[model samples]
Target: MTSTQVPATPARVTAGPALTSAGLVTVLLGAALPLIDFFIVNIALPAIGSDLRTSSATLELVVAAYGIAYAVLLVVGGRLGDAFGRRKLFLIGLTAFTFTSLLCGIAPTALTLVLARAAQGAAAALMLPQVLSIIQAATTGERRSKALGLYGATAGLSMVLGQFLGGALVAADLWGTGWRPIFLVNVPVGIVGLVVARRLIPESRSRNPIGIDRPGTVFLAIALVSLLLPLAEGPVLDWPLWTIALLVVFPFAAAGFVHVERRMERRGGVPLLPPSVMRMPSVRQGLLVGVPFFIGFSAFMFVFAVTLQDGLHLGPFGSGLVTAPLSLAFFAMCLVSSRLVTRFGQRVVAAGLSVQLLGLLVLIGTVLLEWPNLGVLDFAPGMLLCGLGQGLAMTTVFRIVLSKVSPEIAGVGSGMLTTSQQAAMALGVATLGTLFASAGAGPLGMKGAFALVIGIQAVLTVGVITVARRLPDPRL
Candidate 1:
């Protein structure tokens, strides 16, 4: 083996032994910020475009640039965390994220805001992977399992809560900052997270930390940017030449990335992502499950936002109120999900998907029967069902996917898992978002478009449930 090709071993750190209870809370708090930020900004986009006097195209750039940067650098950040220390990387990332949020909040131009969002995304990339890695490195057995479940719950809760908070903040327009508070609010939260994390969170890193795999990194970056950029910007720009060219480059870059990683492994050297890691059935199956879950969840968030504001003529606050039931039930179910998984085992995932499918059917029915007249109260039943279904499915799947990841490469495992999630999310917004936009804009009308997309998602969920039922039970 080459100097850097040491076999995966135990997690080792110079700083401490077990992570404290307070430590887990601190890290989970750190984990929630980036995710919440991701969804929160959407509610404020209209105000952003108007205030900045930027066209629809450039405003979309504000979203795309951050997402692309965040998704691309995730694995790199995770690798660095394993090499350095999780706590150290988390602190640095949190600090940088806070600064960037300030930059975003105060930016004078659309271009600058876009740039700031990119920096913020890069900071998030640096911070997020370490949460899972920290739990992997410091906790064991049931503690680790509980932590992972909570992480999953945190993730599911964050998406809906971000949307809820974003609408409230923008509608309040606190001090007439007009959408700027959404970014600025991160400042205080980030500061608190930084302080608590440094004091309570334990430091950990891999015993055999791998060096940078430059070729793998470059190829992966090209592949994701080629795919994500085109998808993120294509609909906005109406499929320009450059976007098509990038799309054409995506598969080749992805192939090259795979080749580089495998070649490095064959040659007894380390690659950014070890082939062995992906070879695990738990990891593979979990990811397969995650892709569809993330796609559906993100697409729901995206389309619902558009539907509420544009189709129903609701203000941001009213939109949030409509989703309030879902958000609340999602939180409650997330807490209950852990217990259900323990009692029901592998069947819980299938059950969750079934519930989600029913919820979607209810949603379609509600839209068909009530829309144009559907108020916040009228939307409650379907929203509550969706919340319960998603909470159960999301938490259970998270446990399955990351259950077998070893501590030595926890960061890698976490990074790889999260990258897939972000890719699925980007794909969701691109594909389902496009479908909803086109349908809503056409004679389908907002109500019909809404039902159609939810019906499509319901079918997708049914397919996922079939796969979930067929899988072998997870060992964890």
Candidate 2:
């Protein structure tokens, strides 16, 4: 490892025992679970709905309930970690997550599964922010950056792996559990995480940990729920009056959240997010890149899974096989991207965007050309390129977003970034996925819908590149 001095900031000056490699691994393992669970359900949804006799709308809730709860609670979870302790919350969240997974696995009804999924998401919110907070508090400079890269890799890998693994588990029908095994598998993993985390992970909290910013926390939750809830469930419910009311309230809620947080910060009370942190050019521009990138990334994944299965008439495992290259390529590319970032600075994101756009174009062409004949072998090149590009963009943005954050509010900063990401994932699925569903029902059909979403994603990539060029160059 390259030698680098710890930051001389008082937070670092009084830092605890240097974080062990094992500790970092343990926390990162904690990070992987929520993300895995998030996408794992996608492939298993049909199985879940079939077995449970659920309506299409209820099945969609199985996904959205988790995402909405996870997104809303993330910032508060971070604040609690800062005020109490990261390790404590990590353990608490992990334990809750494990039990919730079991609850989901054994759920006998659609409502039961939805509730458990929401609970699992809440548990995840508690656990995830601590992963980033612990890294920011326990490590500095190059070590911190490397840890963040692994976190990013774990994240990107989890999305693809979740789909693949879920397919495998459902296909295997281990003990005839079908979709249940996808969730049950997390129990053992979470138990191991809890055990190792307790032994290896060092406890860390903010040096000047502040009390919960109640107003900011409340408003933040309201804003996110108002926005995410409608987007996630609106189309499924035929865009009801409540959903419309929430959508109308979303802007006012968000503005109120910002106003309250800023007011709290000016009073010298640490808000959920320090307004100053948001004002940083790096954080601002990095988030701009992240919003669309994640929206496109997630929308593409959701749409691809559906197209591979429903449109192409492939089984879960067959569809997963088609996408597995994306995961593998992403993992391989992410392992090396930190060095690329160290060399090329912000331009790496631009380059990654170029590659991602190429990959999207290829995917569009292949789908258009192959249509009914498209299969795993045919998807290899575009999938590989897409994953490589995603790995680069995701890892780079993870670092850039947190680069300027001071350690004192690392939990809050990390929380904000993650919340934005989770919210975007939820929103993308709601909007882009809705668009696909709508288009699929029209004369255009499923292949046409797939092409439409992919094309829009290509446009979104260009938007990210445009914003990326304005970002402050990396200092490394």
Candidate 3:
């Protein structure tokens, strides 16, 4: 090990030299790509459905497939990055993501697009964890804090920007491509990222690399699939026998995963995720706050997109334009989030959540008042408030979650955080989406459905504040 590197573990110390400005930008670009893709399809789903002749059930798969695959394989992807070089994995993943995106752009049918999207998600899983692990390995102290804050900024901006970008691309209909350009646009960006990353990014890997945990990986996959499959497919399929069976299987599969992981730990081997990591007070409590926050955030994005286009009769570009103020607000706040954290400690997250609830209340009131007569301007105030709140909460929560992670397990820690966030996002689409659909189709109509979903999100935002109170103070 290099004498200059910090001592992180008995076997593997942090390997890379301090990150340069160019290297930091490369990794942040890599981080932005996957997050942007996660929501990029939200504003394009209608176009995809019309062009591909897909039913609503199949349309849901188009989104759910990417999120599920991404969530399921993330930890394993991290383990691979640790065993191999992180830079190598990052390159491979970016290449594969580029190819799969091309596949998605050229997909001949709805099923083909769905399958390609899942492949794209798998590529994202392999790529995304390395960004964080590399930062943890290559930077320290103030540099690490700045890098993390940029990552947070990148992440927040990407989610909001995805919808905007998708809308503009779909409306542009480049060469009459319509919805296809959203996926295709990544190809050029991926190519540029690859060139920049290879030149600027340093290669790093764990010194004491362990074998993959085959049993643990299998059990974890089963548990996630069993749980996510039912929630995503149940409403679409009318709660069929298979969905019920999978739901029943989920608990047992989860228990088996926990048992196997513990057994692996006792035998002096690294499991996919060591129980000790989850047992950490900061890690555990921080994830609790993240779940409800992401769930509400993602659901709001999905439902609002559909409502804006289908119910309110706005075009894709018009719908996306409505969110411009939110995106602007989020971007501006993310730039200042590090300063906010320095000043307020963990209270920033609480304050953010409180503001988000206030914004939701504003949105609910606006919907009730304007209803069928709503315009893009009507959503401006509430969306701006929500964005500011999200920026404050999202950036700081990421800091809090990884605050105590040592460099030795940076890959696994990054994987765990991403996995939790992705899982919650997929669940949000399933549960809240189903609620929206069911209630809309009922006598309550679209207006009532929108009201209920926003109300539920407000409740979830409150849950975030409750959990935030339990987090160890970041300033400490």
Candidate 4:
């Protein structure tokens, strides 16, 4: 409500120029890059470790730094896009992401790579929220619904493909670059996105914009780092005293963050994450639906990659090939998910979760029976079913979550959604990943650990199914 702030609702944003076919494709493509990069480093970890001579803790830092930085800055990025221009930030983010990727590609030390990865993540945070905000602002009615469906599908698929592509790229070694190619590949891709997006992607931003919430931003960063950092490093560092201290501090930090944001709103100022936005039934329920799924989804990918490499004795390309069924099935199901929602309503999500449960059971059976003999054929049936379910479940959930958010706050809402997702992924690595690591170290071995994690994921999915049933009617 400050005099300097733009009106809370602007006509230009509400009546945004129609996004062309090419424009939609360009933004969607841009959205996929950051997501893909998040997981693409998974399958390449072993090669990275060998080449960089880094310890397990250092490798985890490589992932954790990027994830933490990304999640922490996400809402702020969205706020900036709204205050400035979505198109301007998108180009800046892409350019910085490319440079950081290059820095990662040529890093001579593990420390340098981690630093560069953190910067790359910040750039991604800046770029991603605009994807949803633009779609929300530019498209309408059926067009908006379809675009959201496609965006959700793209988001979910990118995570899966990241690992597969990482494996393939590392295995290919493209002139003996080995694991470096995984990061280097983004350089060209980012450049292409820049060129296309500048021309095709329509510029859109919030009409009523507010200044940066510096206090809220700092507190949010503190809260996220406190929770995620310890979870990420505790097991690797043998649960040190400092990690314990950070864990003890998390609840307080999180509470303070909420208090600060609420205070800002009470003072008639927009906070980094508006309390009112969080108060929305759809936003809260949406997080409930998204958090567990992403946690399981992320942990599953990392553990699966480790199992394929260390337990099943698959090479990088072999592991990548093994996941081909999962990726293809997900992509296929996503293509039809919007239509399925029209026919089946939100029950598609419940049904999808049910399918996921069955798939997990199938996977348990396969693991118990096949053990070390597991291969593409052995894993394909369960992988296909799981992918199909996730494809439907994720796309529909995203639609429901953002369905109620008005264009006035589209940027913040989108940032919040993606932030929860990225944070959940990091938590997945911290929790289930740690559990798997421990189980493997114990007498049960890697195979037992993998089975245990999948069972846990099944239970998590079942819990999510109950929540999915409670999702407001998509027609709303």
Candidate 5:
């Protein structure tokens, strides 16, 4: 099958409510694991460090290694799913993720846990792309919008809940286990997800299949690793000379990857990211906006965790509870997103950013007002606004970015968008996280450091709004 010979519409399977509902649940379950894993370890990090006697730098690697591997492989994962069957890849990846989660739970040492986390990330790369691809191939228009909205909601809620759940599990020491429950809990959930997915998730593949772009895949992976690894681990490791050199080499490698991809396109070969899609103005702008949005969002979460724990002297559970308002607001706004998008179009995104900015400012004001007296309750007003803003903007952006994509290229397109998001998220933790850490170490302390972080995030939010303005209204 070739691009020109591809059908105008995606080839349909016999989809009914039962199958669709089950599929959605399956994908949502798959989506939840990676995100949950991302933050679940955060609250547990202190526990793990104390238990294993690991340094802050090594512990950072425990997080960074997984993120870097996951971000690097995600595109190839999507392409592989296109070549094979999505259901097949989904099942395999889920099984791998579950097993790796177990490995993470039982690992005897810090080094082993880090390796297991990296494996878990690799498994996530295989599973995550299939969620969007399945939705793309299976649904259209309003139904598609709603599904995407749920995905956004799930993504946000999982980040918040992961912290809470991790905290609770660690505190509970279920089975006399401490932080291990964070990973161990996934065992039962994975079993249920796998069984349901096998029964309900229909196998779907690109009707117009293209051979794997092996060269493109390799170069892209190298380019991503070169860029992401340094950013994520550089500051934590005291900005080593090797990290600087890798960062310097990243752009050239990325350019070469693009050049090779273009050549492949001209020669009628498959490229991991098709040049044609990259040429679309909407796609280009949407990606531009997505990068900053994700970067700021991820960085904020990281900084918040550190601030609550290290700055305010809160325990894991307290920190998690503080974020409850944000999670609740996100859920509430997500429920109304489809209608809001319909009524407001791209402006809804702009409004969301504005609201988010307001929320941040309010939060900043509260921090300034209370200073040393500030606690989780003091954060409620700003958090509610921030949550609402994030929900509105992020979900709207998800819808806009994929608006022009068709089902044939859905896997690659979704891959392109998500890869940008994951890369930005990793960089966010690396760059902004470094800034916060450095500032906190200075005479300024944690409050000043948090204020600086939130200020930068606000600036990024402004950038997102500016880029979003250039996007076509009503999506397509």
Candidate 6:
């Protein structure tokens, strides 16, 4: 049905109990794939490198390629969903993602794996935005909040579980598959999701949908690719001249894309990003705040994993165990996020930042105090606090940013928010991760490198608090 035409309330006949339950599970399954893929490959990276004789540089590409491509195309993916049908795009994206996962599992060379990962990222861009849009359009008020809470919980849990699951799968070497199980495992999950989705999820789309803004899409893609590619690859290659050149062009390309979008909107044409949404203070501010937070978060996860595995002589499962407290705390906080947001308003976010900063400081202290004696148990308390802070800040931002958005613009709004998040995450890994890697090479070693990284995170936390002050007190 068109977005404007609300469907009749489901009767017992059309949406059977089994079908309804299947629909919810299908969307959750869809959401789980992209997140699961992200962290799952991380733990499996060392194994893949050993088995394939791939260098560290190429392995980085395997991870970064997927993130960069996914970040760049998310907005376009959302617009496609609005123009065609969310269900249609979702199905196509899911099928492509499933096939690509197979390709990644069977890849004979590092280059092939990287290329397949890029395609997988593109498919994820198309698939993920539709999940939120579908949920938003299909539910209202309290039900919406509940669905979003579930999503937040799933996201947090999946990231941690991805690591553990990857470790277990690799260790198990199911049928002598070794690291290949990381990708191969998705086959069954995707198949189940597809079958359930086809039988259950109803079709949805915008009425009076605008034609694709081809020029804007092209420029935006170029802008994002130019910006993300260099950062992700520059460190691996030790900052090549071409990488520097791309960095210089990114801003200009981004500006040109914005100008074209504005012109299109003025001429009574629908732009990929509607101008009105940009005008909303809540949306703009939330995005600005989200960038730094996600950047810090993504960088922290990447750096920590590497430090634990490489510097501390821990295995994949050990590294995953080290981070388990953070995930557990995050999940616990998210469960109460709705109530907290309702009671404390935006103050909860500010408090979260403050708490996170404290946690970082404590962790840093432990690093400095214990030095070479530090182990996963010693890190647990601080990591749990960090996770709590993250839960409060990130989940609150997700709700506050989208709370004011209209259902008509839901697809693009979700795209914009998610793209900002993904872009910031990639940037985090590139910038802060680079800093950690570089510092580790010096006399300070891993401890010194970690201290520097946490210092940066502390600074970002302060920025979050400052931004939180500027937001509406009671929140929406």
Q: Candidate 5, overall lDDT?
A: 0.76
lDDT string for model 3 (218-248, tens) is 8877887788768767876799999999999
* Clash count (model 5, backbone only): 0
Candidate 5 stretches with Cα past 4 Å from truth are: 1-24, 55-59, 132-153, 236-238
TM-score of each: 0.87, 0.89, 0.91, 0.90, 0.88, 0.89
Across 316-357, the per-residue lDDT of candidate 6 in tens digits comes to 777777778887787788788778999988788888888899
lDDT of 5 by residue, 1-476 (tens): 00000011123232323238768978888888878777778777767877788754556567666766776677767767766877888898899999999999999998899889889888988887777667766777788887766776686667667868977887788877888989988999999999999888877777565566778777877787787667656766778999999999999889999999999999977576778887777678877887788888877877777677767777678777788888788767877887888887888888998999999999888887788787778889999999899888877776787778775565566666666676677677767877787788888788898999999999988888888887867545
Better model by TM-score, 5 or 6?
Answer: 6
Off by over 4 Å in 4: 1-24, 55-57, 134-150, 156-164, 199-202
Where does candidate 1 stray beyond 4 Å?
A: 1-25, 49-64, 109-111, 134-153, 156-161, 195-204, 404-410
lDDT string for model 1 (1-476, tens) is: 00000112225544457888999998887778877787677666667867898754465456666766776677777778878887898899899999999999999999899899989988987887677778877888898888877776686577677878989998998988988999999999889888888788888887677677789878977987788667756776789999999999999999999999999989987676678878888777776777888788777876787677767878777877887787777778877876787778778888888888888898889889877887888788888888888778776776676678776555556556666666677667667766776677789988888888888899899889888886556545
How does each model score on lDDT? 0.76, 0.78, 0.80, 0.78, 0.76, 0.75
Across residues 1-476, which tens digit of lDDT does each residue of candidate 2 receive? 00000111113223665678999999887888877776678777767867898644565567667867776777777767876888899999999999999999999989899899889988987887788678877888899888866776686678677868978988889987878998999999999998899888888876665577788778877887787667767876789999999999999999999999889988888676678988888888998998888778767877886777778978778877887887787777778887898888888888888898999999999999988997788998999889888878887887788788776555556667766776677677777877887788789999899999999999999888999887777763
Worst 10 residues of 5 by lDDT: 1-10
Please identify which of the two predictions, 2 or 5, would achieve the higher TM-score against the true structure.
Answer: 2
Report the Cα RMSD per candidate. 4.9, 4.2, 4.4, 4.7, 4.7, 4.8
> lDDT for model 6, on a 0 to 1 scale?
0.75
| Clashing pairs in model 2, backbone N/Cα/C closer than 3 A | none
Q: Give the lowest summed-lDDT range of ten residues in model 6.
A: 1-10
Candidate that scores best on lDDT: 3
Counted clashes in each candidate structure: 0, 0, 0, 1, 0, 0
